[model samples]
Target: MNNIALSRWTMSYFVTSLAAFAIAQALMVLGYGFPQAAAAAPATLALVHIVALGWLSLLLCGALFQFVPVLTAHPLHSNSLPLPTLCCLIAGTLALVCGFLQLAGDIHTGPPCFVFAAVLLAAGFGLVLWNLGRTLWAARPLSVPARFVAAGLACLLAVLALGIVFALVLGGALTYGPALRLVHAGLAVHIAAGLGGWLTFTAMGVSYRLLAMFMLAPELDGRGTRLGLALGCGALAVAIVGGVAAIGMGVRTSRVLLIAGALALACLVFYGKDMVHLYRARKRRKIELNSKMAMLAQASLAAAVVLFLLSLALGRLGQLLPALVYLLAFGWLSGLGLAKLYKIVPFLTWLECYGPVLGKKPTPRVQDLVTEQGARKWFLLYFAAVWLGSAILLAGFAPLFRISAAAALFASGGIAFHLLRARLLLDVKPELRLPDGVRKPNILYSFSPKASLR
Candidate 1:
């Protein structure tokens, strides 16, 4: 593992993802639902796909490109993977967006493009997972995050397989009645695997280590930490599986989901409490943007738990479930990921371009890339948007929901624009650069891409 962390490509991905997150939010405000384009509804099924595929997928792909190597004690299998991976991903994303347009414009009146786009997205994910798996397996003895990565990958495959099926239905390759039945039977599992498994599971795994790193807290590997992780993921598993069965099975299994959710709730309560304790015990006095943003995330999750418990007790879970999913995706998971990206991107960019110089004559302090105050402001704005947006949606007020979602769009856009430019500025700050610094030096260092930095 590199003594320091993060890479350039990853940094770029983080920048792009923040941009995508903002764009997706803006689209929500604009009322651009996938199948119901007329209503311009923010919560269209296509919107879900955008948050999942465009924002979360891009962010995670970037993270693994960098962090997975550190976690596994391995370099990329080849440097070649990043570009192709990016191409496949961006193209796949385009296809998926097109598919959404087709589905939304008119299911009966839609274009054939949707069918093509979905297949392209499946291809994109396949390439990403395949290369990522190779790198993870090459790491030898797997770390905890690697194990979580495996779970995430497994879920990605599951989600895609189901997505492929849904795509067929959309294309009319499969008849509607049977296709809808299959989707109804399998939709919960598909959603859970993608949302909880692929996204939330990996986030939890990363933060277990990262939160400790940023805060300089005692490492979270003691009995309490392990117990919390096990309980949380374990309980979640039971709830999801049972949740799936409850949908298709009789009322008995449905009853079991209540029990399972309660167990998961217990785990979440402990997990959140532990994180609070960790934050309180930190050696660093003033928290950075990452920590503050994460705290917001913790609060969001707490709200989600409250919603879940209320839903269960009121026997209105069927009605309340979609809102719950909305909170989890935007408020908790995506918020946390986006918050960390602000820190992670700048740090990684510094590492790849500047890390090797640390022990040499002179080097830049890691803090030089971005300031804390600016980041904190962005994070606060983002969280406020999430809270407001979730509340508006839950209230079932279309105009309010549209407005809040639009605010998120603007906030995220500003973050992406500012962060992207600042990263570039960091690379060429006159004070940060040595007098001899240039992209290339004399013949002695001829032809090496990084020769100038040395």
Candidate 2:
């Protein structure tokens, strides 16, 4: 597996994901050609799907394929699955995007596109979760983050199931009826499961390790760690399942559900605060760009929560809620996902190439795979674009929203390309490491001493 040239597949899929994002951006630019609130809905949805499914999911699949074995001290069930997963995701996303575009033009095509995309997405999601699941299941007594990821995969499955139902709605196969109470009631459940379940849980699971490693802090453990996990997992269940059930009962039940949602947000806040505090309390003073870029994402999420809660309190949800959702999905979720991938891709390349060669022969440090200084410029541009695009979103000009969407694609593409470029430039002598941008060493720190991964 180590000698299988996994780097090529990784780089290729990275390109595929970024290309989709760029195309989506270009489409928005051409579709609207002027900023307007009218295009915001489709535009935001397209952008969210592009970032989450195309860029982040592809990147994560590529990465975990390389590292899961290392983490578990076991070889993967099949080393070739990453390629197929990448292909399915890229193909599936394109179909869905086209379906969405056609549907937006007219209600007719929405259903077909939804079904097609759902099928493809399901295949891709299944491959990823299945592989990761098998690996983690075999590795016993997993660490907290590992357990979180194990749980996160469950949420991912729930999200995908709801997502299929959403597709059914688009396909005209279902409607709101007493018989199909599940469909109407399911939308709320879908959103909660998709938004709060898959996306948030997975991010938290990854962040628990990634943030600590980036900041040079120890991985969470003992009681404080247990509390964090318990709060996170418990709240996710309550808000998604319990809250959705409440909404099914009545309006009054719905309000109680909203409070449960509040508690979910509270869990997020504690998680965020703890991560920030961990970073600030770190022994390493010069934090890397990857870590710093994460702050912008965290800030976006913080603002999203505040705006959402404020809207809820002031009874202005109808007017302001869409904008808030946009901020959370694109600004917060997509942004952080992109920032981290810039580092993760190259690091994976390092492992696939140099991991086995470690200690036996002179080898490049993982940092040798990427240039930190180069990464800094792209992150700066990406964050700048995020703030600018978010501001345009707030102004409610639809054409401006389209433009912001374009900027986001360009910025995000730039970072992903930056990863490829970093890899190509790394043709240095063994042990002559290039400086990876603000590398937090702890993400992979849990490698068992007995493992041959290093």
Candidate 3:
């Protein structure tokens, strides 16, 4: 077995990101934003950024740091990058949040503040791109996960550039004839690129390797894997380019959007079929909770596509777009994130504590670190609320949306509790049996890997 060296700061990112997720959920439950009267309202914009930047982006970065080595069979270019990256991301995200609140009349601030915040965020993202780029380039032979990660990095760069331009326009720092138009139309592309191009693609890439590894299944079929990546990239390019062209030329790109949607659906179908194949071929008969819940996330992606097409067919895409966003953000992206974290946190804990002692003693398995059966309820509630909330939002029931949001809040809180417990090794006893019948207690503290300790 390969010993993957994980960064110590990875958990910091996880903790902070989960905290951001919880805060964002609390805000939604309290009706600070989301399900807004105007989807483009400042409050809605702020909330969206909170989830995107503060929650998902941070989580992605952390996972990358830990898994990049595992994917490439090489340690990170430097362990030092993660600390600065975390600092920049957290500070910049807070600034952006404040700037957004300023726009919402929740605070008073000049437009330049928004520009400043965006610049800070760009700096943060730049650091991460450079760090990961060096790491990926150092690999001997690129793997599928690396390809997906590289593509995701490219999308992140484009998204950051477009995001900075939009920020400048919002900040009154730069004004061009078509800038506002692009900003309006580009918002759709931005979401598509950020969520679909960057987040979804990267998650799929990571899960491809992780699912098989966790389940002791064979690697994904090469032909299907390549096809999925190609189609997924093509879909992103079409959506992004068409969206920009439509905005600049003031033309209807509905056909282009439809084509992109179709390509994305095809990509999902390929991915779904591949996942089903892996599950069927798994050597491990008992599926873990994380992998099980991840299936729901995949199902949610299919559901989102179905809902999006239905909206288009009904000519109510404008009204129903938020519903689509809700399903994608919460059910697909977040649902998968939470599910993975369930396993990741505990596995990392085990690695940190017992990796050195492996082959020398009998240690607790990664599965022994967390109470999966307990977390299963939270996972169930989270998805249920996402489904119910999305339906109510589409139905124009504001009150019911709030109620569903509160349920989501509870679910997220439950997940956070589990994560913390796992990290602290609260559920596991301190003693372990040796192969020769000796018992070692608390040796984990002395023998813990320095890389794990950071």
Query: Backbone clash tally for model 1?
Result: 3
lDDT of 2 by residue, 1-454 (tens): 1322233355566566566556656765676322332434554456556756776566556556655554455566665677788778887887766665665673452347767888888998899898788888887878777777766677778777767666667656657553155555555565566666667666766776676755677666656556766776776677566755665564333554576676677677667767777787776688777777888888888888887888789888757755776677667766777777766665665554445446665666656666677767767776676667666656666556665666666667677766765555443453344332322222222121122333
Q: Tell me model 2's lDDT, rounded to 2 decimals.
A: 0.64
**Model 1 error, position 193 (Å):** 1.2
- How do the predictions measure up, each by TM-score? 0.84, 0.81, 0.93
Residue 206 CA displacement from its true place in model 3, Å: 0.9
- In the range 1-454, model 3's lDDT, one tens digit per residue, is 4555657688888888888998888888888776744788888888888899999999999989888887777778887878888888888888877777777778874555677778788888998999888989998578886788888888898799888888888877778878777786677788888998889988998888888888888877589878988888888888888778877789876777778888988888888888999899999999999999999998899899889888878999988988899899999999999999998888777776666666787787888778988999999999999999999988999777888999998998998898878777677756652334322323112224343311
Compose the digit string of candidate 1's lDDT tens values, residues 1-454: 3442233355545655665677777677777662124323324666676778778988888777666666666665555566566666666666666666665554345456557756676777777787778988877677655666766777677677778777777667767664566565666567666876788777776776677767877655556555655665665566556655565453344555456566656666666777887798899888887788888887888898898878778888766676687788888988788677667655554554455455663656556666666656666777788788667656666567777676666666656655664455443457665423323112111112221111
Give stretches of model 2 more than 4 Å off.
1-12, 31-48, 67-77, 105-113, 174-180, 243-253, 281-283, 356-365, 426-454
RMSD (Å) per prediction: 4.8, 5.7, 3.4
- Taken over the whole model, the C-alpha lDDT of each candidate is 0.65, 0.64, 0.82
On lDDT, the candidate that comes out on top is 3
Best by TM-score: 3
In model 2, state the lDDT of residue 42.
56
Winner by lDDT between candidate 3 and candidate 2: 3
Query: C-alpha displacement of 335 in model 3, angstroms?
Result: 0.5
Candidate 1 Cα errors over 4 Å, as ranges = 1-8, 34-43, 106-114, 175-180, 232-260, 426-429, 433-435, 438-454
